[model samples]
Target: MAKKMLRSVLFACLGNICWSLIAEAAFRKLVTDQNVSDNWRIDSAATSTYDRGNPPDFRGQSCMKRHGTPMSHVAWWVTEEDFTTSDYILCMDESNLRDLKRKSNQVKNCKAKTELLGNYDPQKQLAIEDPYYGNDSDFEVVYQQCARCCRAFLEKAH
Candidate 1:
């Protein structure tokens, strides 16, 4: 009887290991595959919708809230999904890159990238900054970086 119980426990352990491996493979596939052709990826992230949280059911009304006061809204935290999904995850600045990497296993893939939509370059390491708290001129700086990085990404993503 003890032998039979030991065999049963061994079978359960083997089943669990196989299941875990399969789950891990599925997760890795989700992170690495860039199936989307477009550059913009908007999902429920820290900045998108936060603390108030979302109801499992939207019901008749919406529980969603604004991301702070538009111009002042600073929901800039990145999620694992961002790194996993973006064809080329672009960080506005070194700080943003650090935050993104902290939530990622793709630290090797994370880089100081701009979010610029067009007019960019390669072989350059420029970090873009978010347009917040700083002077209006700072926003332009952010714009330039974003434009350059985005342009570079667009040129390369295809």
Candidate 2:
């Protein structure tokens, strides 16, 4: 029998990745603001499922709940083994980059780049700065930066 194919993909964040909340919000915005379908969606590790279905509210529970955390939206706290196996990985900081690099060395197929998506300065490979420790202004900058990169990714994919 043919194996099942994953429709959506996972998003990687930096240490512990509380930022997935931000990434998921951005994902929702990307779909709604960009008019994309929910069929190809992104969710948090707190809400994904391999069986495929509607998203649930695991707000108060750990990702290891009975429903099982879906790989499509793995949190940054996920193990390196899990992160390396993802179809596409997005990191939020230099530390995330280092971990991914280490894992990538071990797993040759892990081609995730620190650059948000595949688009960048081409020869430069710029990484969007982490805004996890700044004021509203910094968050705005990070949001704008993420929006730009995400739009590029969505445009090419859609």
Candidate 3:
């Protein structure tokens, strides 16, 4: 039998420990609930090296647990291969969007359409703020935003 094409998506942020991690987890759950997990590849990465090799923030973990969304991820920076591979490089905030676009241009065969994840938000929120400096409530807000955006994104994917 012929293999199905896998659509690659890379979620990115200044630090992979917060917003991006939430996005990756939310999208993963959305696809799993839809039973289309096998049709897509989802990953999260940072635009900066500051949080590279670290795990998702504790607040984010707590938020996920509160939402019953299972998520485990180690932070890493976006690479040239990621630029050339992902169909969509979705990011939180203008900083991440600018960083990814700048990095994408450095790669000759960049294929990913880098854009703000909030672009998919049904509520018209234009940016998903980094909750690293905030408390658990901030993380919860991030989770809610990610869930909304991810759901909209999946719907549009179909």
Task: Write one digit per residue (lDDT tens) for candidate 1, span 69-115.
Answer: 11111222344444534543333345534444455655455332324
lDDT of each candidate versus the true structure: 0.31, 0.46, 0.91
Clashing pairs in 1: 92-128, 115-146, 116-146, 116-147, 116-150, 117-147
Model 1 spans with C-alpha error above 4 angstroms: 1-77, 106-125
Clash number by candidate, in order? 6, 0, 0
Among the numbered candidates, top lDDT falls to 3
Can you give the TM-score per candidate against the true fold? 0.41, 0.56, 0.96
lDDT of 3 by residue, 1-158 (tens): 98878999999999899999999999998899889999999999999999888988888998898878988988899999998889999999998888888888899988999999999999999899889999999998989999999999888976
Positional deviation of residue 66's Cα in model 3 after best superposition, in angstroms: 1.2
Q: Model 3 segments beyond 4 Å from truth?
A: 1-3
Rank all candidate structures by their lDDT, best first, as comma-separated numbers. Answer: 3, 2, 1
